[model samples]
Target: MPLRSALAAVLVAIIWGLNFVVIDVGLEGMPPTLFLALRFAVVIVPAIFFVPRPKSRFRDVVLIGSFMSLGQFGLLYTALAIGMPAGLASLVLQAQVVLTVVFAALALRETPTRSQVIGVAIGALGLIVVGSGRGAETPALAFFVTIAAASSWAIGNVIARRIGRSGMTSTPLAGLSLTVWSALVVPLPMLALAFALHGSDAVGFALTHLTVPQLLSTGYTAWLASLVGYGIWNTLLARHPASAVVPFTMLVPPIGMTTAWLVLGEIPTIVELGGGVMLLLGVAITTGVLGSGRRRRLRS
Candidate 1:
């Protein structure tokens, strides 16, 4: 990647890293479902009308929405509400990279190179180390929820790579509109599920509560974080390759931890920091960010 693109990737990284904190802020005054509804609603109104659609079907739009919008964010926020620590959740989200690699090979039938294979193995080990140290002295619902959310994120990443082939990088703002529509549409079935299984009180509680900060945060989450952030990311990767962009995402966890610590007064653990370093190293190796010119050419 060029210096400018690298810097752009880093900027995206900071926005994404701090995104967890923003979610915490947004959720403070709003319930998750209501917050998400408002968030998607903001993206879907005028922007959907103005934004051009990708070269895909309505189902593809739905799939993208499920994977990127609902699968990723929905599970993540739920994990936080359930029991996952903010800093740890930040670290756990990085697991999506490994999941993406696995999904790409399976879904797209694209085999990774030798370096990437090595990178994946080393990265998996690092993740295991980090996960082993999770502060769940006992099994907690939140820890499990966080893992489920991260798994969904991985699945979503595979779905995103599928979208990349559609020739619509600039349409992310449009995609957000499309994604929000899908989010609004698909969760209806789940609404029935939530009512039948979880009952009216849980469903009703998540729906009725509202506050200004939460509402503003929701708009910011969808419009700024999901729309603007993912928009730049899609554009960058469409111009480059996943290998070029994903490495910088490794920077997100460190920034996330830092933001959580400074802003939320959460303490950072040594294991978490180490895992973050290893995670970045794995990404660097996978993406050829630090290799020499000859080696970089060889990898390419």
Candidate 2:
């Protein structure tokens, strides 16, 4: 990947990493699905009307939204609400990086380079270390649900790459369009689930009692995290091979852990810290930031 795209991916990781803390704030005031529904609803409306649809088929847009937006966030928020710590959730959710690579190789025939494979392997080990050190305390159900969210996100990544490869998403607004339009499939279903699970009374109470912090959290998540973050992310996916793009997500866990420590008081264990360091090393390898420097040194 080019430096510009690589930097964009890093930016998305920072936004999304801090996003876990923000989600905690929003969930304090409302049910998970309700919060999720409102987030997507806000992503629509004025923006959707202004943004043209992606050039892909309407159903493909729906498919991307269902997995990427609805399935991913719904399960994730639910996991966080139920007891998955923000820091650990961030680390665990990176299961999607490996999942995306595997799905891309199988579905798109995009074989990863040897460095990517080695870097991903080391990153996977880091995930295991982090998970084993902290995940024992997490509720079993919440842990599994988060894994499900990762699977859904991985599938969405592959689909987005496929659409991008098809030459349909060539517009500058392609990412924004896909993000806005695909979100059309999220709100109603989430709202229905919210009513069913929480009852209309609880949902209504949460809506009326939305505090300023909660509203701010929702706005950050909707605009910055969902719209801008994902818009850039999807565009980058369209531009680069999945292997080149997905590993950058390894940065999110470290950023998420640091943010959680600062904001939520979730301190990391020694083991988790070590694992995070390994994760960074793995990302450096996979992204070839390390290798490129080595080559430059030899040439000079």
Candidate 3:
């Protein structure tokens, strides 16, 4: 990957890392399902009117929106609300990296190199260590839901790779337009889901009683995380192999853990920290940054 695209991916990681803290704070005052509804509602508004749809097929856009927006965020918010800690949630969701690689290989024929496979295995082991330390604390339902959220995000990544390969324009502006327009397809289904889960009364109550922090969380997630983060992310995926782009997401947990500590005052356990280190090392290996020089030296 180019340095610039790498930087862009890092930027998205930072934004998303902090996003868990923001969601946790937001959920303090709002119902989870309702919070999701509001976030997507903010995502698609007057802005959707201005952002032209991407040249991708309507079905592609809908699938992307459903998985990325509705499935991922909806399940994630509920998991946090139900009892998953912000720091742990961040780490667990990195499971999507493994899932993405699998889906990309099966669906897109983007086979992983041996090094990539090794890295993913290391990362999965790290996740196991982290989960062993923290698993006793989180609710079973919340834990399973978070796993489901990760699966949803992985599916979305594959769909994004598919869209990129299908010849959609991927200029930065087009990327932003795609993000916003794809988001436009989410609100109705999300709202209906929110209603089905939480009921219309709960949704109305949450909306009427919106706190400032909740509103800010909705805004940040809509504009910064969804629009800016996903826009840059989709652009990178469009230009690179899914394996190359998806490994950048491994940075998210470290950032997420740190931000959760700083903002939410949730400290990590010693075991979790060790796991985090292993996770970062795995990401470096998976991206070929950690072992590239040695590999080239051996080749020479």
Candidate 4:
């Protein structure tokens, strides 16, 4: 990848990493549902008018929207709400890479190479180390939720790959997602359950107790991170080879950790630092950044 692509990767990582801190801020007085509502609103309005739509069908729009917006964010935010730490949430989500490879092998018939298996094993080891460091009694529960979130994300990735070909991919993806959460998904049953389970106190507190900073944080998460951040990243994806570009995602967790430290004053644990390095190294190897066969094949 060019230095420009590397820098773009870093920019996306920084914006995303700060999102965990932003979510913490936004959740102060904002219900996750309402916050998500406001988020997509920003994308659909003034901005959507400016960006052109892709050539894909409404069904395709719904497909990617469900995976990318609904599935990915729903599980992720719920996991965070359920006591998953922000930086750790960022780190644990690395399970998506593993899920993606496995899904591709099964569904798309992509054969796994030796390099991928080695990368995944190292990545799994990093996940184990991170889990051990988490002070939770039921580390297994946290891990299960984290992995579920990753699997949902992987599903979204596959959908997005299809949508990205259309010129209007990002806008529709963002628009459809916000619409799903706000209009379809956030019906009375959802709120009724939220109220029943957490009580009006928790839900009520989130709404009335929100601040200006919190609102902006939520806006950033929905608009900038989802809309602009993913928009640019997907545009890059449309131009670059998947093997060349996708590897940059491993950099996101580290970026998120640094952002959490700087913004939230949460220093990374020693384990997080090591795990982050291992994860990135694993990604690098998986992407063929360390390829010897390429050189040999070139010579041949």
Q: Pick the candidate with the highest TM-score.
A: 3
- Arrange candidates, best lDDT first: 2, 3, 1, 4
Give the TM-score (vs. native) of candidate 3: 0.91
RMSD after CA superposition, every candidate: 3.5, 2.2, 2.2, 4.3
Model 4: lowest-lDDT 10 consecutive positions: 178-187
lDDT leader: 2
Query: Residue by residue across 176-208, what tens digits does model 4's lDDT show?
Result: 333333223323444565576668787777667
Lowest summed lDDT over 10 consecutive residues: which window, candidate 1? 172-181
Stretches off by above 4 angstroms in model 2 are 113-115, 135-137, 278-300
Q: Kindly give the stretch of ten consecutive residues in candidate 2 with the minimal lDDT sum.
A: 128-137
Write the residue-wise lDDT of candidate 1 on 1-300 in tens digits.
789878877888888888888888777734455455566666666666766665656786677677667767767777776656676678778777766676778887878878777777877777666666656431356655666776776665566656666664545454344444455543554455456655688667766765666766777777777667766666665556565666677778888888888887877466756775676566566555656456778988
The whole-model C-alpha lDDT of candidate 4 against the native structure comes to: 0.64
Report lDDT (CA) for all predictions.
0.67, 0.86, 0.82, 0.64
Angstrom error of the Cα, residue 121, model 3: value is 2.6
Question: The CA-based lDDT of model 3 is what?
Answer: 0.82
**Candidate 3 residue pairs that clash:** none
Q: How many collisions per candidate? A: 0, 0, 0, 5
C-alpha TM-score for every candidate: 0.82, 0.91, 0.91, 0.79
Candidate 3 residues 1-300, lDDT tens each?
A: 789888999999999999999899999967776778778788778778878878889999888888888899888998998898898788888888877876777888877889889988887787777666664567878877887999999999999888888876545476777787778666776678778977888888888888899888989998999888998988887788776888778778878888888887888778877886776667667667668768889999
